[model samples]
Target: MYKFLLFLTASALPGVAAAQSADSDPAEAALAEIVERQDAARQPVELPDGRATQPVTLDAATITVTATGLGTTIQSTGQAVVVIDRKEIEQVQGADITRVLQRTPGLSLSRNGGAGSFTGVNLRGANAEQLLVLVDGVRVADPASPSGGFDFGNLLTGTVGKLDLLRGSNSTIWGSDAIGGVLDIATCGGSGVQGSFEYGARDTRFAQAAGGLETGALALGLTGSWFATDGFSAAANGTEPDGFEQFALGGSVFADVTDQLEVFAHANWSEGTLDIDGFAAPSFTLGDTAETQDTRRLWGDVGFAYYGNDLTLRAAYSMADTERDNFDPAAGSAPTFASDGHSERVQLRGEYRVLGGLSVAFGGEREWTAYSTSFNAREETGISGAYVQLGWVMGRLAAHIGSRIDDHDIFGTKTSFGADVSYGLGSDWRVRASVGEGFKAPTLFQLLSDFGNPRLRPEESTSFDIGIEQGQRGRGTHLALTAFRRDSADLIAFVSCFGATGGLCTDRPFGTYANTASARAQGIEAEAGIAVAEGFRLSAVYSLIDAEDRISGNELARRPRHSATLFADYEAAFGLRLGADLRLVSDSFDNAANSIRLDNYAVFDLRAAMPVSDVFEVFGRVENLFAENYQTAAGYASPGRGAFIGVRAAM
Candidate 1:
């Protein structure tokens, strides 16, 4: 790895020397090149229903072919879905990954302090561990036991190009812990010179810069962001911690291995510090602060694809070494490491078209993960799985069905399967139905977790969803309403010991991550977007959620009852745009006992943009404009009202 890093550094030396030849690079050569390419490859396909559609929204429903396996799109199927573009992300700069996750429907995000703190999500009301997250299609999740949790804080906002939210049970195509759904973050690819820099504040002080450049077939991109503040008080009132951060850098090389094939090689790396400035214990305040952690990620992926008349053959391998070191409190004290995990995945898949409107995709993959820690524990796990999917469309009826079976070294074998049927109801209406089983394999953190029991089994789930979609195209509207119900067994939960015996158990085995009685989650998702007129758009989403354990009858922790968002944007002549939105969440409970009640809150945001010329545009936004103080995070406080203004210089 060191050698590889050195080679990359050496290769980049020329660009550095060239930039240094100039005075501060004021010409902004990079941004001009990036715009040239983004307009070239991967054209957004027209939405089947003629609404706002892009390659991401339409293709996420199928995992057909890619580095991970077969890549698919949601718009290609009837599954509930949503896709957010890089433009949106860039416009909302300074917002953490968790905040970006919240803007999407059927998903909820919570975080601690600022950067690198414990930022997590309650995806569709499923356990945090039950929701799976992927970066460029490879899983980026906590190796800790199941229910151990994934960190939203680790993702650098600038490195992300787009986010695809495949709503509903996705275990059938994605495998374990996909009990809820998948959040796929595809990094910016096929780069040319592109970069942006800005200074802003929204309850905090911050600065950010990101850019990408390409030479020949190799493209390199990097982004860095920093923030500081005396944060707001907790929900109940206490000094919110001061969180500081530093994360940046990513690069990729794309070369056509042959006229009919190509290969992609990429790497992502970052380092940061998180100071838990808040006090959990007043008496121990002197030594109370949580250690500042140093973090890092090194990953690589390579693949070859052959495009034939009616078939595509693809194969790829991906590997990543992820580490986080916890430095203890006090000056010059050594840190006790929490975990250092490594993962590797290899996949082979082929897609063939048997006839018009009919295609079949099949593939197999193997993944290995190992965890090493200074906490007196370690675990190794492997997953071998194969999947087959068929899609058939004739006239107004389209049908899709898929089945996958994953064999684990432990926990025996598990299978997930689902079928979807959609029929075009005349007069601008279509109806669809789907049913499937999902599962979340216990993570090493859950099974061999430091304080965990080894006898635990994988959690199992089954879900059913039915929906109606209707709308017009281009100048029309798109709408979908879906209702879902899921039943799960061997549900995992923290088994509390209470008082003195409780706090001592830091591992999952001690008082948490136990296989509990069964559980269930039922909910409704409604989404709609329309272009009423040229350059004018309106959109809204609503979700009513109910999540709980059947046996314990305890309301699952951190699950909110209802969440909804409404947004409107208007585009006028002469390159002018304006938008506003409102987000609402119902009251929620924090623990199993339901002793903590968080009041419901609604937030409003406004934005406006105008072109100074064809190549540059000045934009501004006001978040939490009303200054309503609220907490989406548990004990961690949230910032109040804030504002920012900037300019985008595009070619």
Candidate 2:
């Protein structure tokens, strides 16, 4: 893996080096010459709905693809969604994806400690494992994890170009884990040169570089970044400091094979090391132990897409690999734990226009997954699924319906379905409603681990939402309100083996995984944005959630009941930009039965930037401006009052 990443880096060095020269790069000129021969490959296709394929751009007013797994305008879709562009990310000057996501409505985040530590995310009152995360259309969940979830701590913001979040259940559109919502991330790519470097508190350093070339029917891009920090201690009671380091590399290529066929490929690799902290040791002594973890993640996809006047078809293959090792130097023993897992998927899908204002989509997918660990033997599983969906629109009215059937080797077969409708009231007002069913198959670890339960059933959920929105054209003003409810049954949880009998206790001998849990969550989300002046804007979002375990009647852990954010930004003709935001979270429980309490907290951030020339800019920001001391997780302290300054260059 290291060798592969090295080769990719070496291949792109000449272009990066040439970018630093005062004269135009000869390599770039050569690329142009090569592209000149492929000018007659791909052509734009017009859909029956009058939508035309164009160069991908970050225009929030236009459309998004994540909501429906197909192209649809934000205002036209019945689902609630938000788009965050690269410019908005830079305005916040944050390096962690979790920090950026916390500013959105109906989302909550908790971390074990500072940067690079274990982080948990809750969307619309759904658990972390219930939220699906996608990077460039590839699922990134770790099958080896107890809950088969993605870790947001390892996703840096330096290479992210766009983020699309759909807030509700749509398992029929995606797959498992969509019971919470979906976070779709797009990496940086364009026909230009761009990079940044920064120095901050705690001996921190950061650097990023990207290069791209596009001509005729072909385009290529590469981006890489490095980050390191002597982070604060992960445990509040420990004096030893923990640190983290990361390196990431990504590349993509697109080529038009013919007027109707286009081929594309993308790959990303990330490896990092993080310091770990332990709790109290024997005799009640604070465990300032020396522990560390090394983690590696790799993902790639390749496929061909064909576009016809009335039909579109796509076929693709993708895979994700994750490996991690944990060690304790203080104990002077071998690695304490390790896990390796991988997932591979193949899918074929097509969309055809059935009439003037109606379209239909059909697809089939097959997936294989496997996991290995130090203590457990390797295990594998497979699933196959097929689905169909219909979309229709007539002036102010739009509707969508979809259904899917998934067959698992052990769980037999299960079906899910969803439908949504929207009606536009005049030009500025609209109302929407949706209902959906979702299911999550047991994770490989959950079913095959030491505490395995081969007879466990899949978790199932039903969700519904209704909302109203108002938007003003050419006025930069929008307001939306939504109320949603979700009920889940047969959720998996570990149960003690004392008094257990028969096959349940035969697997683990200690505790057994069982379908002994049920839950309910309901929430209200409100968002508003307006142009305060010609160059200044203000936006805010507020969420109220009631999440509880139905059987125990206890509030879910680590989910705040009330959370809100307010943001303001301004830009001047003189190349100056200013931005600030405030985030507020109410107190919530840290453990089941609502016994442990985590305090409520508020954080403030400020940033400013100015361009000296068209190619260069300088910027700075202050996080936790008031130096507030807070903890999102018990015994874990959040960063306070840190300043970062950086310079960016683009050509």
Candidate 3:
């Protein structure tokens, strides 16, 4: 039936020639028909497993909002960007978002243990703290964390419907904490109800429900998910098993008050409880302990938009709150440690087309952040920023230039500039280049905690990239290659005050944060996709990176020099789908000292699905098919081979 569906899809193309025409090549014509349909509908055809048979492409019709703070086609933006839609998310079939993200180029992951553990995603070998994350347009970074970074541990994929990853520095448009890149995530939306449930290895259970309503003047959506697992030991040599549980809920609403005006609001909340292993007494070594960490996060935003013939305006207010608590059975019944953080932001932005091929985009924003720990008093700071961008598009060439200025309550003022150009050689080829500047202010915790440094300077960085692409991804044969480099200075690092009696350590005996480090990262990324046959496809992504510290000349921790992913999928005529993927990583150090090494490893996964009816489908997958034993971090044992089965329903 797969071929019959393809035939029906091809026949629906409005202006395309028939696939079976004697004057046309059947394979080429069929692929062209698929691409046309994808572009016209803005949605790809789904396979039995709810995955798109063909990957989404960055054609003129495909627009990305993350690249320029406004909708822009990838063909017009020089920045490296990747997009994943809901269909692709279901293809991975797991709660862990990292699994689906790993397939993207120039990206890698490091987790402390199994699912729900502290996980970090590194882009182009940049520090995890340098990347900015947004959920439904709300910044969710933890202000109380040492580096003010978002932890991916509790970020499940159940409610996420789309993701846009813009790689490289983009401070001119996004302001601070965008030194590495930006990740924009949108929640599920539509006019129907859908749900899924699965039970897997390690006694794991996962469930999700989402529903939406759409009318001529209004739209509403709500989503909820739950996850629980009896996980394996976090410590490699430990005996006892660790467990984790999480709950999440989100809602959104949009109303058209007039023909040219709209109002919208979004809210999300999540809570997680994770059993963790810590240094045990007596030996003071890494071991299993009766310890657990609880985290709760809440974020929301409300906004309005106005549209005109040649102008658009938007205004928004957003807020985020985070609370964390740690407990140890041996310590006491109450929590042993706790922290709270909060952020509020207000912004106004607008864009206008000055000419048929020229436009101007501008925005201004103000943010206030506060944090408090059990041992410290509440502290707060504020920052305000403004930016402007000029975009020009003439025929096959497109370019953008932008600048920004930010005033920090404690750090004074700073300026950033960026530029990019993209030129299309033909319908099947394109070349692009870009350069950007980035800066990040010190976090509240880094400046006000017991180990804080009141005189710390902001971290700064410069990034550049050049690339060439042939053909669109998942259309016939496609290939892309890119070279990138980034240099960072005044990087924050912890400084030990042991036995010191002078300088900044005169009154401090433990440790303090300071801007005393520099680093450089360079890498090359390559990606290829082939439509090998009518119902089969293959894709691969690879990256070579060299990340080093300028002061110590040592390789940065937990960054592998080489990494690659290979994936293949096939759809049979019997309404059955099969897929497999393999991931490979080279050896890397687990510490800044470069003494401990994590061994090189490879992991494989297999999955299959079949539709039982028009509304329900069954699926299963086996992860770590070979049961490979490896670690992404020292002392942390990764999950072994596991199997899971599930059913999905849609209306």
Candidate 4:
């Protein structure tokens, strides 16, 4: 049967490709009793799960998902994906998405040193660049910039309303960068008045204010935030200091021209400075020290959506202008790098509830990325693609199948396919499984980089996942467990000690980027949330990864062995919320050679807030409570235990 589906989806030829459920469970006991009765009869009874036949609710679904490129709620989709809302973002006091991901299970990172400059994100076994980053559904990659890839430094936990982390292969829906997975950022439109202030140890501080005010057809919102830190010391004598500071501002607006047509836009800008450090701090001399290099990014996107009785037409235009300059006075001739990117995509997808429990939809996208670098020649990419997906439903059975064909101008053409199936075992419980093929084309920087190589080939992957989800009726408590495995081919890796002229790294000069042998990654993720009691709740997230090479006998660069995160909070009757958390990362290597080792460490944090009055509230947090020295970057140490305090005022 699975083979039939594969052949069918694959044959859809040059053809193609292709959440969260928002359902309530009632009297799980009744469902279990039925199961028991069937088991006693020594037969596979038809069972009784009324939910298997209910219609999906539109508003109560999960919008961002991995299995299908389309936006839909969790309960309605057939995949293993999760959404991290703003409330949960605070429940963890997480400064970066990486910190939040460690607790997410099945996902991990390879931190450069700190969130200072070059950082990357890895999903499954794919390289950091393979995991795509999107803001308001617009692509944010330079293709021409080195880390034009996804850099966690841009992580603004405070500026986002929610985060959608989709596991497995997403090439079918998102195009190239979707190989390993996709990280979708959804910004809040600021409705009504809102704000928050948090301060902690090591001179760390953060403040944000946002609100949405609507006066008829026009809805507008403004949000801005500031972040800074004194940092920690990795090696006692390391010359560079362990600290940093940043300032950011942004806003969004939306208007409804009619009951069926709406337009929206968002923008953000940030700048900061940080101390430099050497590999073996305290014992080694600082290399290429920079007091701070200032950077600013401006992202703007405008889109129009028309929702009809059965069809939707959506179009968006986006532009990203990222500029960076080194403030260090000594690094002579160090060219300032800048990236300008633009994308325009129009999607025509329509869905209809077929006669029975079956629904079908099809759509296509033409995406163009024009990237220019201040230090090198420009590179361009044009990808035209179309896909169709079908969702079949019946009592106790449902399946989703999808396929996509992308035509790339320079990287060669490619195709992707995927399918997912799920059946509710009974109240509060469901089992799911999925299989798919994914890919990542060469980035502009990888192909036309200063040390760029033109012979680079696209990276590819095969993946599978099995998961279980459970939630209590109406209480908002939920638990999920998912196990995943991925195999990557023609994996891309940075080789050191290349060509003659100087380069980013001596070995990387003439080395140029090339598809390495292969890699394998397997892991499990688990999460839980429960209202400990009314007004108080706790959430826990954890992930484990075992990633490695196919023949080199080396572990992939930057992928960690284990990670765990814990969050707890208490909400007071006065509308105040207090929270605490613990974060941990296991040991791992920084390079492919696996010589440089990063030690394992766990850090704790505490935060509290009080609704002082009707228009004011005060909050603060102490990070790294134990002062346990750790390095997000290989040689540099992160900030030690520190405290920050602040206030929020709104009308």
Candidate 5:
């Protein structure tokens, strides 16, 4: 692996040397090229110092592809969404994606321990399992998990270039597990070669490289990354140190078959090994133990697109496979626990213009999911869905109405409906509203496991939101406020049968899954950005969420009621950039009973970067500047003060 990485780095040295000998600064030139690409996609936002910057909030010119499953400007869609480009991503100066994502409104995250631990992301007060996550346009959820949710712990920001987060339910377009929202991640793309190397606290080492080539009718790209760290103890009271290591590779190919047709393919693979603490013998309490986990994931998709004067067609086949194994050194050399999950999907979609300013979108999809565990046999299920939508754009008004019908092999049939409208109040102001329905079928483990209940019902929800925006991006100031509410029914929950003799414990003496819970989540999201002065900018995001269980009337676990972030960036002399950010999270319960209370905490971070030469730049960051001790989970310990430095090169 090291040799291959060296080879990749050496292949790009010639280009770097050539750029270095140029008259212009290579760093500045690279920044200019990135800005030019962003401008071509959306309206360019500039700082008071005449430097280009990505906006913190969605503006009229911002385009979103996740909202409607098609490229549409924010002004034409009623759904609340946020977009983060590469420039903003690099500003964070970290591999952990959760660190940057938490700055967005209506989003929160909880990790079991430091990096490489199990991480969960919650949006708009909804559970992590209730949302959908897509990477490179492929669903990466693990079907073998209890809730079939995506884990963010292993997701590093190495190759990611863009992220679009749509904050509302829209199962009418995307089938299952979209009750909360959708997170769409796209990998880096462009005709360039870039790489970075870093060394940080805890003996951490990181390296990443990406290169892309664009010819007349063909475009290709490749990316690779490696990370290793001697992490701190996971248990709050443990003394032993844990560790983690990971390697990832990705590639993409796109070719123009004809003037109006194109084909593309993308693939990514990753493997990681992590040392974890688990329950010990005798006391059976959570603490330091000689246990470790190994995980491997592969995701890929092949698709084609055809463009005509007034019609567009697309088709794709995607697949994702995940395997996990847990080992205990005390037990034996063999893995104590093992599981694997696989998902395959085929989809075809098209859009046709019915008349002026009017168009219709329709699509159909078939999916198959299967899972196997050490103790349980392989189980599989299939689902098929079809949807149609009508969009109208007239003058300053835009509206979309859509519906979908899905048939599950075991759950029978389900239908969903959604509608949204947006109207421009003026050139710099707009108002929007939307209503949608969502549903998620039970996972294979929930229905086929030893403690599973075959009579479980699918979870369903109804959501509504309205919002208003004022001021245009790069125009000195921008602000947006949105309020949303969602009601869920038939939520799946586990029921323990420790002492029960009858009922759900007749045959299974451990536990059984059932749909005996309901919930309601309502909240307000506010965002603001201002050019404080020349060479400086300030942005703030706040969220007030009230998420509760209807049955117990208690706030959901790990869902903070009030969260806010304040960020500032300044461009100083000699092409130097400095940044600081503060994050505040209110206290919340750690369990359904609301007995374990997690304390509120605030964290601060500082970062800076300076150009060393035309082809290389140096950057450093201090995490947890105040060294404030805090914990997001009851038994897990969050990282304290840590410092890291890295160098980046582009050609």
Candidate 6:
């Protein structure tokens, strides 16, 4: 059945390719996500409330705050960063986070089933556990999880205003769990009100509302969203259906105590319930047994800032908590498994301009983490870290150097260093390169769970990347290419305890975590965007990766060797817009041993919007237009063709 769908989509490709003229090069439109703004000055624009708004020109070099916690444009920084703003997010209309993140060149995602299911994100071939995820500068990872990673499935794009995806390692700035990279998400905040409602296939429903207000030195923002779906069976061979329901709320407040000082606080809450199909234990076969999961998460932060003409100081306290419960009726159990994780953090940061064209930024942080499960004893750990970075910019050249030390109660200490340089080759061209080190501490569960090993060591990594970019704004053309490599060591993996080594105890028949894995990943990414015509634009991206486990001589699980995407949009009369996207992914193995193979596939989507007035608009989209059946995980089915329509209003 899937083969027929694949052939149908492949057959339609020739017509689209033939429509493009040789003179039309869609490089500028395609590379818009990565190209830096090209401004030559740092100016401050004041708002109506006498507050200064950071200056950001559309054509100016892309400025980044996640790389160094200091504002620096991509044209001047050596790190590879991709920025996704609210405008793009609105156009995509993604219900969840994974849909948006998978469009990036070097990022890949795997899901066990449909929306709200367990999802994993891999950046540049790195495991989900190796990356760090931050929401408004606060870490939201689950300390009780075996991998200590955040679940993308639970996050919605409706509340996000900006997303910064930084590729390559830079633990020197973000501390541990940055062996891959960083995903910094900034929630929506501003004076305005917007609301949306949608209905889609399979009894899917969505609704969202957001608003903000500012008066004098005080500002407040609030947002909420709800989603529900009658989803398909989670297992491939199952006939029963599963469903999901979720809700989220977020708010923030800020006040200026004095001219140079300000205070701020924010809180976020999300809860969800998911119905699932379970497999018969021991046989590993899908059955009619019913299972379900209930999840609740909360995050809060309070902070103060002192902004000076050439110096800035800030401090913040943050906390995050996550609780999950699983129930299985077939086992006649009230709750088969239940776990809770919490983390608390305090940080101080200072940045100063000590010399002309030279500035220094330094900070220190302390964190406490705890985990508890129904079947295991509660455990806790502490971590302390400090970092310093120096930045120098002169004419067309920019350079940055930084280092950090992280001390963990169980793993002792680990140090990392990183540096990057960017040079403007000419008015239309720029080149940049970066080299960095990264590390990850063992999660509390890995050290205290029943299958844990207390003596586990931290994983380490080294990575580097180089790239070149060229853009002709007047001609509406842009191009970018990047190559990167990463080597990791001492990766923690479960090992059988039956064969004891080095006089280690072997009381448990299962396995324990051990530092026994090493791997290397290399990839190339190319992006281009061009205006095909006055009313039409096209963008395309291609990525290639070679990731493997060195000791086992096996390819990394679920990391595709080839992937590409083509996007086209057209503006018509009467405030009408049309867009289409096609994505292609090659076959990949789903397990560590490279035994389970998933087939290659292509999926296409179509969307359209029409504005009835300045404040009202209607939009619709068709996903999996050809009903291409594919899977990112073995024994899991992808969504078939689905249609959705929605309306949005703003005041």
Q: Which stretches of candidate 4 lie over 4 Å from their true place?
A: 1-61, 65-67, 113-116, 230-239, 242-245, 273-288, 331-356, 372-375, 393-396, 472-477, 495-509, 572-576
What tens-digit string does per-residue lDDT give for candidate 4 at 248-344? Answer: 6667666778876777777776666655453334545645344455556667677776554444455666766666554444545554344554455
TM-score of each: 0.83, 0.90, 0.91, 0.83, 0.92, 0.90
- TM-score computed on alpha carbons, candidate 4: 0.83
Q: Candidate 3 on 360-420: residue-level lDDT in tens?
A: 9899999999998888899999999999999876556679999999999988898989999
- The numbered model that scores best in TM-score is 5
TM-score of decoy 2: 0.90
Candidate 1 residue 86 Cα shift, in angstroms, is 1.7
lDDT of each: 0.63, 0.78, 0.82, 0.63, 0.82, 0.78
Clashes of each: 29, 1, 1, 48, 0, 20
Q: Candidate 2 or 6, higher TM-score?
A: 2
User: Residue 574 error for model 1, in Å?
Assistant: 2.2
Residue-wise lDDT of candidate 6 within 1-651, one digit each (tens)?
322332232222211011111111111111221222112233343434565433223321254556786455556688888776655666777586765676578887788777888888888899988889988788999888888998887788757766778898999888999888998876766666666667899888777666667777877888677788898877877777678888787898878799768788888898888886667678867654589999999998999877665677778999999999999887677789999999999998877766655778899999999999988878999999999999876656679999999999998999999999987665457898999999999999888788888899999999999999776221378788999999999999888867665433455566788899999999898878899887788988788999999999999999999988888888886668899889899999999999999889999989998777666778889989999999988887778899999877766
Could you tell me the lDDT of residue 412 within candidate 4?
70
TM-score for candidate 5, please give it.
Answer: 0.92
lDDT at 86, model 1: 62
- Runs in model 5 with CA error above 4 Å? 2-61, 471-475, 502-504
